[model samples]
Target: MAAVELTVFQVILLFWSLRTAVSQVEMRCPSSCGNICIPYPFGMEEGSYLDERFKILCNSSSGVPKLTVDGTKLEVRDISVRRSTIGVMFPVVSANCGGKDRNTVVDLEGSPFVFSSENYFIARGCGNLALMNQNQSTIGVCVSICDKNRDSMMASCSGTDCCQTTIPSFLKVFNVTMKGLDDGKGSSGEKQCRYAYLVAQSWINYGSYYSDVGGDSDPYDMRHRDSVPVVLDWGIDERVFESLVKNGSFHNSSYSSTCQFLNPSINSTNQSSTVQCSCRPGFEGNPYRYGICEAGRAYDNYRRKIKAKMAGIGVGVGFGALFLLIGLWWLYKVFKRKRSEKLKKKYFKRNGGLLLQEQLSSGEVSVEKIKMFPSKELDKATDHYNVNRTLGQGGQGTVYKGMLADGKIVAVKKSKVIDEGNLRQFINEVVLLSQINHRNVVKLLGCCLETELPLLVYEFIPNGTLYQFLHDPNEEFPLTWEMRLRIAAEVAGALFYLHSAASLPIFHRDIKSTNILLDEKYRAKVADFGTSRSVSIDQTHVTTQVQGTFGYLDPEYFQSSQFTDKSDVYSFGVVLVELLTGQKAISFKRSEEQGRSLATYFIMAMESNCLFDILDPQVVKQGEREDVLMVASLARSCLRLNGKERPTMKEVTMVLERIKKSENLTVQQESEYDRKEVMGAPWDVTSASTISSFDIGAPSSLDEKPLLHTY
Candidate 1:
């Protein structure tokens, strides 16, 4: 009897211990502070969060509960566990120049948060120059200009009284200074109040502050508010979680099933070894909490089946075979899913996903514009890369026309069997393309890296390449002189943007007619960036392996392997020659004297004073003689053997714009003259000068001789 009583006592003790463990695992904590939901790893009290850094304070003295972070008391607006981002209200710094200045400094020194690149640094005031400094170094600058007209001052932040620029990624702390131009002297001789701050880009676009302009208030005036919304990216260190796992202290039951570690490259000497944790597919909720990530509907259905089977165990004996088959099928599906996920992860790592992630985390590349597409989605979009969907094939890869699930048409580029050496180039293309926002540059919609080869998705251009239009004539759509000139101007503008206007200077190593695509509107969109590279602002050249189309390749780059922006100019010059002659860059059918090169042939024709003789008959017929001569001169300047002697893309763009403007004005004048007189003056080509005079804007190297003068 005593033994039996002891057994009952032991059973109760075991049940009590089990219940206690379950209770600890399911312990409830405050989920929110006012409107912001505080998900674990982040909490309002000790023992509720993963670490001291994630602790937040809730203040309700102002009637409404407010969540604040660290000693800065930055008000928390929202927290997203899925995106690992927190929205906080950051104060705007105002400076009154010669008066009381309110320059603010934000320091997040020891926190796990970094300022997101999706925020923009804005400065608002007339004739004020704002500079954002980090670690005493100027990181960003923008100048606001006031309109000369006082009564009709523009109420827009489009560089008039307000200017905005993007902030760098991985930024932890920064300060803003608003310096007035000419010692704060305003049009009214009154000291101007300049406001500067970093705000979420999306918030600036949709916020009510911009639309709240009334009476004489400035449109960008933020004096009424103390702060604006800013985005902060937060992540936990991978080592901390790994240590917990090793010590058997991590109690999050759903962590293994829901969370995956984002391993960014770590620099122990200079930076913290931090990593991001995100919930896995088919799961939702806090990954840092015990059993918080709830399963999706499919998982819930599977659980229901298990529960049903357990409840009907006795009945299942009669239909044992049927139950066994269902169990086997379910097991097969689960195994297949796990295997597929493992393979995808392997491919992702192999295809430079981790390297790209490092670049993104380091703020070297902006992540807002690029998307990671799933392999299955791309496969379906391209119909398994059907032959019929093929758009074009190149040495680098093949492009396919695809329709996404949303019925959006895109051009998908699938790389060939690239070795590890070329992998960096592939990734380089993705990073460089993501940063570009010019209209004439091809838009990178997204990419897929989980397959054997990486895939890049771009906006589809309905019209074919410029090379096809120039070399392969179409009866339905003829290439006119005006269209060619417009295309040339647009291409030059794109190259200029790459070289000068971008956040970083980009060198398009390959610039050929075949690489320039035309959209439905016949607008030029520069494509094929597999060989492109971005250089620092101070870097004049990048020494790389000589790679370019033979005829279009810069001679200096081929010999020295030092590629500068001028290398691209040389290639563009060849494209110009192609436009003028309407012949292949390299033709074996040409005579030995022409050296099988169109560039050489065109130069020879120009020197011999018979450029028109070699020019396409259609070009001579449709284009004005003087306009043709001016363009030919510009092309010659660009094709200079010495890279330094060649005109920059900026100079080329300016000269082309001037020529186009002149053509427009001349056309208007000619139209008026024809209306006034029945017959127009005839041209005397024999007596007229062989070369037309126009400013080519060539570098000082060309100052010795006129661009259009006879050799």
Candidate 2:
């Protein structure tokens, strides 16, 4: 029995299928362009079509008849009906010859026309192997032997720089991959690069088989020389050209253009058994005749003269209409601009810009140190805040790059969606950020309120967020041991400043690496205070609704609504694990044993004494495995589910500083002593003697692993 399907979903799908079918409809061709009479079975678009199968695209981007088929352009010079071929200029390969230093690349991401079984492949090179495939299925492989360009090269396909092989007939979708073969051993010289192309029949001279040059090489040089073009046999419904000599007619409008079947003589190999009907030359409306080919002036110019004159009068009226349209368009643009200005003014007032200005005048909202950028200024800086400017994206909003009037660069954050609920919070964040002055925090420069949504401006940090630098593949910056320690220290200090040094004790509820911005020199700056709360000086903890990034959220706070300074420490601990392992805090790629969060993995690794295994090789290269281990251990201590078990941000900062100083002292002592002297030169994971061991089987020093606990 079958499952019952939803009626509404089926109806929607049926409607969509019908729409797609109607859009793909085509007609036969008298597709005319530049005195070239195009025949039936060729199409341009919906209105002017020959047939779907033979569609020709006239790209007018450069104001010339540059042609394309399916989106890939082929320098199509001519198409001969009798010859059944398209003359195209396939690009030639150029070799860069440099001794011992070489790089060869071939990109065929987009192209049309498949390698047929009738097509042949020839190669010339030593230490080279050629491979060709289609749709992940291998067709053939060829290996060549020859190192340097010899003075007298052989003209035979005899295991040397030359070899030839043919492909299966009428095959579509081809991909070529090549490598160098060094004797049977592997690669050497300029011959290491293998070059191949489908050669045009004209380029293949009688005596030019596998030789680098032609016999009668004149001043014209005989050919361009690099890529030798091969001819591909093309047909509608046949592999062999002779098979197209059909017995009957085909109604091509029903499917993707029909012709004779895959045969030498027409006895249709097609599903319906071959019947072909091609439109006659010079007279093409449609094979279906029902297929629409809108009337063009050149077809019946004698009768069209009067219609053409009236068309010219209509064209003049059209120009007047176009002129009226242009005038209306200009007027519409002016109206749009006025409407936008009014909206901006409305938003400016609504966003408390007037109140901000009043505060600025009264010395409440300081404008001297902060900025008030015009919306236009930011739009030009970020190319209207294009998708490319996006630094990171999430459920909240997107951050962009912007430049201020004073020549300072800033990060402009635009909300994903704006409404009344958070509008006051947005303004408050900016106002609070503007008042803050701290070296360890990402500084708020200014903001733009006269836009659809509020735009937050902050000091630009070029090194990106610590999260991306630690884990994103696209980001090449791997967190080195020293850099990691320094970043951790800086982040701790920043949090300490936010918690105490600020006018109010601010809880940066989200303190993950993703929220920590880095400057050019890897200077850490704490950011993303969207979930932060301001509490009184005497308060040790604040009661609030739980909210933060998953993987780094304080477990205690998540379970209970109470958040504290230790909550920030726990979140920062997740950042520390990221720095050590060079993996995402919440990575999907992990063994089932190692939980999703980096903190969980780090704790597991620390417990198992396999923390070194999870660390980045770049950090391992830093020769401070002991110091790295200590930091990982500290990070482990911070991630303890119980808030009481986690270190204070102040202690975290102090311990990190002590670790750096101790490493420096150890290095100095090793330099002062002989090879055999001193406790150890530096920590090295590879040098087993210097590696530190952590106990895995023992119970955690913390009381217990609580199911959930906040600060």
Q: For residue 360, what is the lDDT in candidate 2?
A: 56
120-212: candidate 1 lDDT, tens digit per residue: 888877787888776677877898877556444444576767788887767777678777775334343127777888888777666465554
Per-residue C-alpha lDDT of model 2 across residues 1-711, encoded as one tens digit per residue? 011125334544655554444344323325554434455444456645333445666654542233454454554455544344555444433233223222222222222233334345554455556666655667667666774554333334545665556655544434565666656444353454455544453445354443544553321122335433434334443322222223213333423222444332212122222223333432323332332222222234333454466467556765447667557767887999999999999988777677666655785444455577889999987878965577766555889876656777778888655566765556657666776688878888778888877787878999887777765644454566777788888888888777768777778888887788889888998887766776778877878767888998988888887888878888888888788778888877887677877777776666565767878887778847557656765676677676766656666776677677777565434222122211223222222111012222223323334334433
lDDT for residue 356 in candidate 2, whole number 0-100: 65
Which residue pairs show backbone clashes in model 1? none
Per-model CA lDDT versus the true structure = 0.75, 0.59
Span of 10 residues, lowest total lDDT, candidate 1: 671-680
lDDT of 1: 0.75
Off by over 4 Å in 1: 1-320, 664-693, 696-711
